[model samples]
Target chain A: MQAYRTLTRRELARYFLTSTGYIIIAAVTFLIGFSFVVLLLKLQQDSTLMPVTELFYITPFFWLILLLAPPVITMRLFALEKFSGTFETLMTTPVSDLQVVLAKFTAALIFYVVMWLPLLGCVLIVRHYTSDPAALDAGALGTTFLGIVLLGCLFISLGCCASALTRSQGVAAMLSLMLSVSLFLLSFLAKELPGTSSWQAQALGFFSLVEQMHDFARGIIDTRPMVLYLSLTAFFLFLTLRAVESRRWK
Target chain B: MRNGLMIQVANLTKRYAGHTAVSNISFTVERGEIVGLLGPNGAGKSTTMRILACFLPGTSGTVRIAGLDVFHQSDEVRRRIGYMPENNPLHLDMRVREYLKFRARLKGLSRKQSRGRGDIVMEQCGITDVSRRIIGQLSKGYRQRVGLADALVNEPELLILDEPTIGLDPNQIRSVRQLIKGLAGNHTVLISTHILPEAEMTCNRMVIMYEGRIMAAGTSENLQRLMSNTNQVIAEIAAPLADLNECWAQTAEIQQFDVSPAEGEYFRCALTARNGLDLRPIVYSLARERGWYLRELTLTRYSLEDIYVHVTRPDEEKEEGA
Candidate 1:
């Protein structure tokens, strides 16, 4: 337990000690803040009292912010260590491969959360603009944050796994970006595929993160999407551990 | 952890896709011994060190560190050993003290123990002044000190440093050697270095490796004796070659001489004297018999350099043959 804690703390400190960490935080914050402002402006120009709160929930900017967050934050987690030759010393330490993977996953998740804090400010702005305060729907905002946690874990896990597969941070980030974009595209495609409007569509919707986001933004807290995200997160984390352990073979 | 043999290996072999990094080889280190692994580049020293550190398992052999099998009991083996790999890789982003603290904790030290041990190791490595400085901003010498400090943080029973002084200046190399020498009685150190003087200066024993095999391992003097029983004597005479040859005769130990006549009035003669005989006095008497002017007659003893070349010579011949 102490070994794991030290590993986690070192992994967390790895971010702040380099320029890349601050760059990641700055880019994510700016993108999220800018998108939230645009979404606010888009809602204010409407004449029919188009709910500002609905705009917050429906905008692609929120999902875009979420999608862009993890790969940048998690790319150097394993890749830099391998490139800088620290991976050998790290492996020879008392900590196991599983601990190293989890520590990195946890650190990326923490950074991922900080990167998404700008969403809270957007939610507050939505609350202040409502004419009927009761129509604000705080429960939906809470579920949206819950959805963010699941999505962040799943995305960060994928990023760590990708980082483990390569020694170049740029390649790691690009690989994770491709995987994330493909998943997002697949989720959108699932809603449009033929013969998918029945029960099968609902079943396929579980794999569609966009559908889950839409449902969660509508104040629907389904246990099925949460379960799917958590399981996939675990699966990718296991893969990261395997990748880390594979260094011993050659 | 400190009770028995520090290391024991038998038939260790590491193979990559199409080649072997380490062939079938075996060696051991007793408790409280400082041994040097001397080899040229790609001679399998680093590969062998990595395997002993439990970073990789041997393809077909067994490695026991502190009496625990490296393959099955790696956690226990890791606890007993501190490994500073080749290039001395460190987290350059981290402050030296911060890195040491993290390493101490990872090595299973308690919070209080980590703090105290980190300080002790920093002082020992002469890097206490730079403890607050970031590793990347420091010179390569200081980074090597931080690496040494990291390896000593846990008070490991065995220390494996692969080419620890590889890229340091002469002053830094001296300090690192002194630091390693200071560790001789307490910790069993296995350092791999291609520098012959480092082995002669610090190691109690030397293991000369070539082509993934140990060509020789002993004290430096013992390995030197293994090179040859016959010593080469160079005799420089100002007298004429005909007069020197007329005085020279083949004795039991002294035989044929390879003579190179100099441009000036000197003949440079080299002789192979068998049984390590001192031929200078015999040559002096012969010169007096012919009244030849003996300018220089010196018998050279083999150093570690000569032994290294002699031991690694066969592979070079085979390579040329190929």
Candidate 2:
């Protein structure tokens, strides 16, 4: 536990010291903030009684931030270590591979949360602008935030796994982009295919992170999507740990 | 197994797709000993050092450090060893002190202990002045020193350095060498370098390796003595080649002579004296009798380079036959 803490602290310090962290945060905030304004204008023009509905509708924009920001932040987690020759130094240390992977994952997650902060402010702005703020669906807002956080965690883990596979940050980022996009589109592909492929539908539905976000967006705190998101996060994290371990043997 | 033997290896083999990097090599380092792993490029010095540091596992063999098997008890082995690779592996954005403290923490030092140890190591490596400076801003020599400081943060029992002074200039090299020499009695060090002089100056005992095997391992004096029987004499004489060869052929101790013309009337002749012969007095008298002005007369000794080339020569059989 002490080792993990130290590693995490140092990893976080490194993230802030580099330009990547600031760039990621600024980019995500701008994109999400822009989407929030667009949604607000559309809602105002329609004069919908429920202003929070548009806020829930804007939740999908966070996925764009989730998918893009994490790869940028996490691709260099292990890839840079390998390129900079620190992987050998880390391997020779007393710390375990699991500790190293988790340290990197936690740092990326923290950065993800900070990136979400500006979006949180957007939510507060939506609440303040509504005439009847009390009518706003707090349950939907809470669930959407939870879902975005879970998806961010999952994406960070996937990026970490990709980074562990190679020393090239560009390759790691591309692989993570491919993996996240495929998983995001799995539900749509399953719907397009014919036959009694209920298994494929169930699997894709279970793995489709964006689909899970839909339930939260509609103000439903379903246990299934929550558990699914958590499991996906854990699975990818385990794969990242395994990839790091295999590097030693090679 | 005794008090001095800190690391021991037997039949250590590491193979990659039928090509062995370190093939059945065996050696041991006693406590407080600085042993040099000398070899040409691609001779597996780095691979061997990596295996000893537990950074990589051997395909087969036993590596015991501090009396613990490397493969079976890697965590324990790692705790006892500090490794600084050929490339300085560091987070360039982090401050020097912060980086060292992080490394100390990773090596199982407590929070307070890491802080204290980081300071001591930074000062010991002479990087305390740059402790707050970002690693990327430092020069290569300072970066190498910081790497050394990170390795020493845990105060491990054994230090494994792979070409630690490789890219440093003369002054940096000397300072780093002095630092390693200052660590003589406190830690058992195993340094690998293709630079023969670095090994000759810093290491107490040397292991000469070639083609993934130990060609020779002993004290510098012992390795030098192996080639000491065939003596070389460099004599500068103010005489013509004809007169020098006439005197040299008559002297039974002169096994072979190669003469090269020097300035004006002087000639530099390299003489290979017979085994166990001292021809300095004989050459002086010959020059005196011929009234040849002797500008210089000195017997040459074999250096580490000579031993390195002699042992690892491609034509070892032919050279031995000669």
Candidate 3:
């Protein structure tokens, strides 16, 4: 437990101190803030009856920022260490490979959470401008945050696995970007394909993060998407651990 | 297992992809001893060190460090070793003190202990002045010192330094050697260096390796004594070539003599002498009797380089010479 905490602290320090970390977070925050305002104002002008926050949560623009943040944020995590040859030093320490990977994964996840915090300002903006006290659905907002957190875990874990696969940060970023984009596209296809009423469609829908987002935006407390995200997150995190341990053999 | 043995590697081999890097090799280092793994580049010194340090897995055989099996009990073995790998890789963005503190904590030191040990190692490696400086910003010498400090931060029983002074200047090399020599009583050091003289100066014993195999291992005196038969006496005599030939042939201790013709009326003569025989007195007497002008007459005692060359020298060279 102490080793885990020490590595987590060091990994967090690595992210916070690096310019790339700040740049990626700042860029994602800016994009989220812009998309939030644009989506809210566009919805307000088009239809005053629809909830602006709900529409903003389901926007493709916000999801684009979500998909890009992981690749940018996690590309430097393990790839930089491998490139600099510090991974060997870190591995030779008393800590196990699992601890190193978890620490890095947790750091990236924490930063991903921080990146999503800017979107919360949209709720604040709505609350500040609205004269109606009941306009903000607190339950829906909680579910939205939960959905975002779980999705971020899955994405960041995938990105970390990609980073662990190579020493080049550029290649790592490219791989994560490609992987997340493919996953997002495949899930969207599963949601958009024919036979939406069939059990097959429901099966495909389990992997559809778009469907998950829509349900989350509506304040639905379904456990299927959470299960899917959590399981895949574990799968990728295991791969990262395996990648860290592979250095000993090769 | 010997009572006080700190490191014992037997039949340790490492094969990467298709080719073997370290062939079946064995060696031991007693506690508080400084041993050098001397070899040329690609001679598997780093591979062997990595295996002992628990950084890489050995393909076969056993490595016991401080009584812990390296492959099976690696984490325990790692806790007992302070390994400074080749190139001294470090987190360039981290401050020197911060890196040391992190390493100390990773080695399971308490927070209070981490701070104290970090300072002690920084002081020991003489990097206290630059403790707050970023690792990448420091000069190569300072960065290497920081690596050394990181290794020592854990206060482990064994220290494995791979070419610690590979590219340092003369002053830096001397300081590192002084630091290593000072560590003899406290930490058993296994240093790997391709530089022969560095090994000669820093190591108490050496294991000379070539082509992924250990050729010989012993102290400088031991290796020389082992190769005492090949000891040569070289002389440059300013006499007639025939007179020099006759004098060298008449010397009883001389086993063989090779006289090469020179540009001037001097012969560059190298005579292989018998073991433990002093041929200089006879050569001096012969020079006096013939009224010869002797330019140079010296017994060639085998150095670490000579022993390394003789042990690693190919069979073809020996055959051609014979």
Q: Could you give the fnat of all candidates in order? A: 0.88, 0.83, 0.83
Model 2 Cα displacement at A105 (Å)? Answer: 1.3
lDDT, residue A178, model 2: 91
Q: Which regions of candidate 2 deviate over 4 angstroms?
A: A47-60, A195-203, B242-256, B273-297, B315-322
Q: Is candidate 2 or candidate 3 better by TM-score?
A: 3
Error of 3 at A205 (Å): 2.7
Residue A131, model 2: Cα distance from true site in angstroms? 2.7
Per-residue lDDT, model 2, residue B262, is 90
Measured with C-alpha atoms, the lDDT of residue B264 in candidate 1 is: 88
- In the predicted model 3, the residue pairs found to clash are none
* Cα distance off (Å), candidate 2, residue A115: 1.3
What DockQ score does model 3 reach against the true complex?
0.73
The sequence of per-residue lDDT tens digits that candidate 2 reaches over residues A66-102 is: 6788888889999999898889998999888888988
Off by over 4 Å in 1: A45-54, A129-131, A197-204, B1-3, B241-264, B274-282
TM-score for the first chain of model 2?
0.91
lDDT of 2 by residue, B1-322 (tens): 3365888899998987768888999999899999999999999999998888887889999999988998889999899888999876788888998888888888999889999999999899999999999999999999999999988999989999999998799999999999999888889999999999999999999998888899999999999888887788899998878998888888899999989999988999998899857779989998888899999999888899999998898656777989
